[model samples]
Target: MRGSPPLPREFRLVPGRTFVDASVLVRLFDDDEPVRQAAARALVGDLNGPALVVSGPVLAEFAETVMVRLARPLAPVAVRRALTELSELTVVSADASLVLAAADTAEEEELGLRDALTLEAAVLGGCDRLATEAMRHGTVLRGIHVEDPAFGGNE
Candidate 1:
């Protein structure tokens, strides 16, 4: 995910960074449902993260969702800006090791490939906690805590 600053094939958590999954990012900008929209907005607005952790897959996922899943697709420029905003965070590119571990984690956890990959990325990226709706709230996978910030919550 990083090039200019350069990142190792394996990522290391910067100091204090929480892994943010694409679901959270999508919710943050989505307004299809008023209650959920407000919850997402509040979650993000309340976070004053000194630093954040994200992966290449997470950014791509967010871009695709905002561009395709919304009631009206966002303009290319809008999508680009959103991606840029996310990319500005501490970014890590998932590597072969990460994928393999994710596969193991997925199999053990019975999670879909995407969910496992996101969780695996967070663990490998060294985030102590993951903000996502991909798994049960308070569930721990790969030693990383998972939490869904949605008020209405994952249904």
Candidate 2:
């Protein structure tokens, strides 16, 4: 069996240094939700990471949910504004190779397609950590650490 890859170098929490996943993004904007508040606080306040990293697929998925389906659907102008602000983040694109990698990761980890894609994007973007509320503690993907900001930090 192949050995697990080495962990990426530890990154100091500086501005522009971490990748923000869809889960965190959803929470950041959903102020009504407690989890979202916690994540937003952790990210925008405490983490102090430089240039948040976001993937194209992640943005598209978030837009579909927050702009299309949510009861208080985001207006086009609002969505555009959000996207523009997010553009300040280091955006990673998912190409053919990354798609294939995501498929492979899904098969290996038994994760759903979206989760696999998220993992692939994080790895490609050279993220040391992926912040999300969806994953449990101690979950590792391609040597990148998965952290649930809501439950983490106290440990």
Per-model C-alpha RMSD: 5.6, 4.1
Q: How accurate locally, in lDDT, is each candidate?
A: 0.74, 0.71
Q: What clash pairs does model 1 have?
A: none
TM-score per candidate = 0.80, 0.81
lDDT tens readout by residue for model 1, 51-140: 567899999988998899888778889989988777777776888877777777778889998898898778667677788877788877
What lDDT tens digits, residue by residue, belong to model 2 across residues 1-155?
22234434642233235667777777766756776567666775664434467899889877776787665677888888888877777787888777877888888888888888888778767777777766665677767778777765424
Backbone collisions counted per model = 0, 9
RMSD of 1: 5.6
**Candidate achieving the largest lDDT:** 1
Residue 133 miss distance in model 1 (angstroms): 1.7
